[model samples]
Target chain A: MTVAPMLSVSGLAVDYQLSSGALFRKHRSLNAVADVSFDIAPGETLGLVGESGSGKTTVGRAVLRRISAAKGTIVFDGEDITRLKGERLRRLRSRMQIVLQDPYTSLNPRMTVADIIAEPLIVHGLASSAEETRVVVAELLERVGLPRDAADRYPHSFSGGQRQRIGIARALALKPSLIVADEPVSALDVSVRAQVVNLMQDLQRDLDISYLFIAHDLAIVRHISHRVAIMYAGRIVEIAPRAAIYNRPIHPYTEALLSAVPIANPKLQRVRRRIVHPGEAVDIANPPSGCRFHPRCPLATERCRNEAPHLLRKAAEHFAACWNRDA
Target chain B: MTSPLLEIDNLHVCFDTRAGTVQALRGVSLSLAPGETLGIVGESGSGKSVTAQAVMGLIDVPGRISEGEVRWQGRPLAGRNADRDARPVWGKEITMVFQNPMTSLNPLMTVGSQISEVIELHLGLSRPAARRRAAELLSSVGISGAERRLDQYPHEFSGGMRQRVMIAMGIACEPKLLIADEPTTALDVTIQAQILELMAELQEKMGLAIVLITHDLGIVAGLCHRVAVMYAGQIVETGLVDAIFENPLHPYTQGLIRSTPGLDAEEERLTAIEGAPPGLLQPPAGCSFLPRCPIGDKGCEAPQAMRIFETGMVACRKAGVPAWSEAL
Candidate 1:
């Protein structure tokens, strides 16, 4: 049929060892992400969303092999990338790139904008001559809303939003088939946020690039993503099309999260209920038996407390973890 | 009814800096009745935080409220009250939850002890009793393992947990009002929801009013009962939340709302308010927003002034800018 998806993950598990593997005593391990699986089709964007420490970042890092996966398979371009090491891993990194959250921190202050955008090309030998590199770098900077003259200026001179444009230009330097953007515009001012997001959407359309967009803001993710995945603790609590997740959430956590997002207009707030879960997030080191969300779940039952649930199909192409999905 | 809860009349806060006097808040007047959430919405440096700081009597030194009267519960506050040994009544009568909880909290102290200290000193609870109550308060704000977490340092908790701890500490003494200054700026969206829910629940249980100082319109839309739109150290528009949103009066308020793209909108291009906010060091002369005003009439050129209309208020020089209109 049509060639396999650009990026695919099955049974992906990422856990951090609190201590080393030396001691006789059993060291604790925090399961940052467990048994997570998703696919990013070519030219489509999948938004991964969760609160702080939800392990969404870990997933992005794992897919790029930045961190060692405890278990699972990562298939990129129909080849198993999970076991690739050294030279092979380095080669694969060019096709799948990352655009970090803070543009100020990601770009080297010492380097000029020209050098910053040309990094991936020079490293991967995509450009041979300085003149050829200059032409490519100029084109990228312009595409991301920066002027061609910006190539000579240092990162410090640019505003917060302009710096982010530089970061996007750098990510596209290698013409990466897939990109992992983690909170790309969250730190930016409200006025500039939209422009950057729109630019990204434009880049995706023109270049046929797929994105694994990870962020905390739903309103932002809703605009760009084809599918949305909500994370809790370290698991994908719900995953579905954008419309299904935002308008008709199946998981209680998802519902609460959707309700919690503040609307732009001040008037329609009465319809919003202040959902208060009077318990804390479960410890990742020793998550609750069965459902990790059981402690704070409003409709928790005996089965929910002890019987672990998986991604059960609640609707077409929609999956939820709740035992009582109907509820 | 009895002199309102806190009456801030003709308040003018300014800074006498090396450059010149920065007019932060200019002749701003607002009185809050107990159990009313007044949302002061504005962009950065709109003097929302300064107003909250003024209420707490914690305005930074060298920054003076050049003119105004601050009356708390019908008594003039000059660092004294009915009792002779009264502090500014800040942190006790009107506690505040700041934007970044990590910086606000004492990193050296345990979370539990820090919260307990407030209850012990203000509410006159015993150390043991205060610790017990602290655990309850922590649990009440959606913090898990409340007792165990009490002994943990601020760095040990996540961002959301840290904010919840600040809320617990702010409400420890049952302050009539809680000033949450951008409480969710550091948090992600889902955690922000949880925090808002917790804050609303606590307000209901404790019968506390909240003055939410934030730049996020979404929080203002979903939370505040009333809002005071601020610009260049002045309240340009003050009205009920619905009235303000449905019918924004001033050009600045309209610009902010238009700039934000709606979640459900099927549109492509978003309207952006061009240019940056004006520097307060040399405030704009005739109509601060005149440079960017889309509806600036001839009156805009001749010193912008506040106009009190029926629904709310507007500070525009436009002749026909109504307080409540679908024109926006």
Candidate 2:
């Protein structure tokens, strides 16, 4: 009775090569992501929450084959697309799309709305003629709650929220089954952010599309995601269902991140005890030998400092990589 | 409030752009007492930052305070020769912390020089004395290895550490008031919490008053004693943090509260305000939020003024009426 996942990524790792000097030509490889594993079920969102440079965006890019992964397998719809390239990769791109964070710079100012949304269809050869593409573009505009007349205007004429809608319309033009939305609503205003989040949820219900939602804002992630994964340094520290992750997080990093977010209620915020962890995330190139978070963890023991723990099952659907948390 | 420390009376700021005159602030008034934290929460183009800049006498040509005055300790600080008058207390008594620390700190100068410059200029300390005081200030802000870290440039420090250095420089002169505009917006949540904690500790130790301008309601709720909600360059509501959060009288305030998704939100959908804020150029004569107000009626077409209500000051024609009960 369990449906197969739309996208599955296991043991994914990405590395960036850094050249120290032009004369010496000494090269060093920085491991940005390591041993990351997750699955996105059909029509379900897997929210990837992490701070800046935690490799959340690297995971998203690796899944789409935009960047080559140094290790691990990325299976899309039961097909191993880890090494896809040439015509095959071009065809696979039609099945998945991406929406960037900044709407102001994502769209081209010179192109009209119709051209911006229709470029994908034309590039992929999805439609037959200009007339046919126009029909699909109008339908997409309506689907994303924009007027058809907007097709004639440029991106500079639209507001931030409206430009985001245009970007969403362009992403939907390919009828993508999976969307890699990287901080999609982080650059938006507070009131307009909800409208886009609601629209994404509604589209998910109607189209049965899965999403890899990458963001740093936990509250928005909790609102839109069905499953959540907390990442630190370059690994998945914890993964669980939304309620389980928020209510009973097993990893110390997850607990600290949750407690640090300020609540909106004044009365509740006054009495809330914040677990302010010291220092920022470790440098990816020179991570610690044991747990990457041991330096800042309050409950770090000798075992946690010497041995790196593998992800162990804590509940039916909860998994955490910590030596102290017992099942 | 025991003789307000800073009082802004009917402030109006305008910018003369190529297109036309843009009214950035329209008759905005606020009062702050000593050692109090007032949170100014609003979206972009809400004139919150402009109010802070005006209070600091930072507004320049092409954008002038067309009307009203800003008084500091019952002394006029905004008018002709305002800059000459404000120069005495501008940096020594009133300081500011910007959003992005990376851009605010000079890349060429070492962290020690930046902190020492402020101390030497204000406190009349010698070079070596100021440098020693700089290291002490850095340690007070929780930066480890303060002496070594002081010699390093800003590029060597992490984002969180750079922000801490900024705070160290901000408090080097023992300023009486601090104007922070989205101070923690560029930091992560954990680092933001640490910075907010540092600011609170500094306030308690120095008895410093703060004017915090940000777009996040959660930060305001946590750190501020009072809150002012601004919209389209006007103060829609101002009251105690508890009263505003519990029972918001203005429709804009109510909408903002409902729109913000809480950490423990049970509702599936957030109540979004439909339209975007109006353009500043040639804004409507009536309430700026009238077009987006849920319970807007014919009476809202006329300009509304801030009036005292049961809980606080609201600028709505139907402040405490029951008509909004169903609409909200």
Candidate 3:
């Protein structure tokens, strides 16, 4: 018997208001994330991959309660957090944290490593005296592979990799069961990216933490995630085990995404059929009906033009929102 | 052979820092074929961008192309030396798309006018023709309702949209060669795929040779025909994409592949390259990657200049190119 998932986002939606069209015009809502749903098992890493406007980051922020959800329920630890408010909401935030994409900007330049890490502890009232906070901060820093002396230095003093380590330290300060890592390594140098990703993996293994690892990087996500979720036009189209997703992706979008990723093997690289990418802006504010991706999908069919497929379970554990899963 | 689109022979770039002259690119050599996509792969400061800058003749001062030659279409480019503060190669035979769109684009200028400027300046088209060309370019890059978007500012567009505009600007006049510096590094995965596909398609349609600079090996694997792996401002590994991927002779190339997350194996522990990538100022003796060479010991003590194998090349003393039998 399997236990209920730790976090479930169902029919999640978000829309931001635009400027008035005329003197007494009705406000138009721009749908950023539309009816998106997925689940994260306990201690599982759910890799969310999508384009810039696909609203993957928005889903993460909504789950963390940093952004308001216009619709749907975010159930965490078996509790509905969609309408959760006041102290309960504040308490929920402590249980969930965010590690931002730009480590350099996410950290305050004026704040020392010790202060940055301790701020979360002090905010949550997890530590009492200043001495206790210092000890906790130092421990967190060391946990991310930083020397104890790194505690006193400001964020600017650290390299991009080092700054990310500080960000990880801060994220782990709350002992959060779920952490939203939004493009955590996109800003670091290539070689340095490995150091931080490895550190995060080690932390997750040791602490049994769950992660909503959001990134445009497929390879990195493939490295750390237990399962993968591919999103497009503010909705989820595919969800599967990491190996299943990488090796035998179900959805055409997933396949196209995988195909576009350059292989290190030259022979395969030369022979692989490229799913020629569509132009950048197809105006997703009002996405095409039926299949939002029909415009770019190589194997799109007439049935695709008139029918918007729902996310349905294809295998025992795999789920995909597409017409031809078996294809 | 018909003259390669672009050639760099014994290229060296250096910045006159207060500490000393920091050598960025050391004897970097590459030749591009017309309408081909050449992927330059390396870490940050690996001279990938430096190569692009030098080719565009946009190297900043006190940085200069201290030595070497950059030949374009069998002719040496006019400004062999970049001015300390001049946009020397703007809107000409070669164009560049920077990683960041908003910063590269003019916030105050309309998108149409920005692209039209390229056509007008480079191709010497009239204002009306330039505007029409801008609209066509915008439409080609997938910014629909191009007529309206032509008037839009960079801020009015999304990240992907702005990048589309950047692509439009780059190819407005149909440059013979396009240098894209980490074009999709700032984009999301799905969007990155889209942008990459678009670039590939555009390259085919326009028949333009492209210099795509990125650190992602996966990119070189898929999009690039030939790849040059740069380290310490030098081309450490140069070969066909398949050759380099299957048999990486350089330790740096090997370390990169091992670090990337993939489906090939379940890596319980990632084999990270040791120490930092040596600083350009000091670098390492013999091999630039000697400090972080995973397979290095005392055997790599001798200096080794780059050598070409059948389909690839490497700069390593102890290591020989992986034989065809070993690859399988």
TM-score (chain A only) for the predictions, listed in order: 0.96, 0.98, 0.95
| Candidate DockQ scores, in order | 0.42, 0.81, 0.46
**Taking the tens digit of each residue's C-alpha lDDT, what string does model 2 give over A279-313?**
67898888988989999998889988898777789
- Per-prediction count of colliding residue pairs? 1, 0, 4
lDDT tens digits by residue: candidate 2, B1-328: 5899888898999999999999999989999999999999988899999999999888888999999888888788885435455667887888899999999999999999999999999999999999999999999999989999989999999888898898888888998889999999999898898899899999999999999998888899899999999999999999999999988888888888887888886777887777799999998989999998777889889899788976679999877553234333
DockQ, computed on Cα atoms, for candidate 1: 0.42
- The lDDT for every candidate, in the order shown, is 0.83, 0.90, 0.81
Please list the residue runs of candidate 3 whose C-alpha ends up more than 4 Å from where it truly belongs after superposition. A21-25, A275-284, A287-309, A322-327, B1-5, B16-22, B31-37, B68-91, B107-116, B123-176, B187-207, B263-269, B281-286, B297-304, B321-328
> Highest lDDT among the candidates is held by which one?
2
Which digits, one per residue and each the tens of the lDDT, describe model 1 over residues B98-216? 99998989999999899999998888899999999999999988777898998999999988889999999999888988999999988867678778878878878888889999888
Tens digits of per-residue lDDT, candidate 3, B277-323, equal: 66788666677777666556686776677776899778876445332
The all-Cα superposition gives candidate 2 an RMSD in Å to the true structure of 1.6
Q: Residue B296's C-alpha lDDT in candidate 1?
A: 70
Worst 10 residues of 3 chain B by lDDT: B319-328
Please give, as one word, the docking class of candidate 1: acceptable
Candidate 3 chain A weakest ten by summed lDDT: A274-283
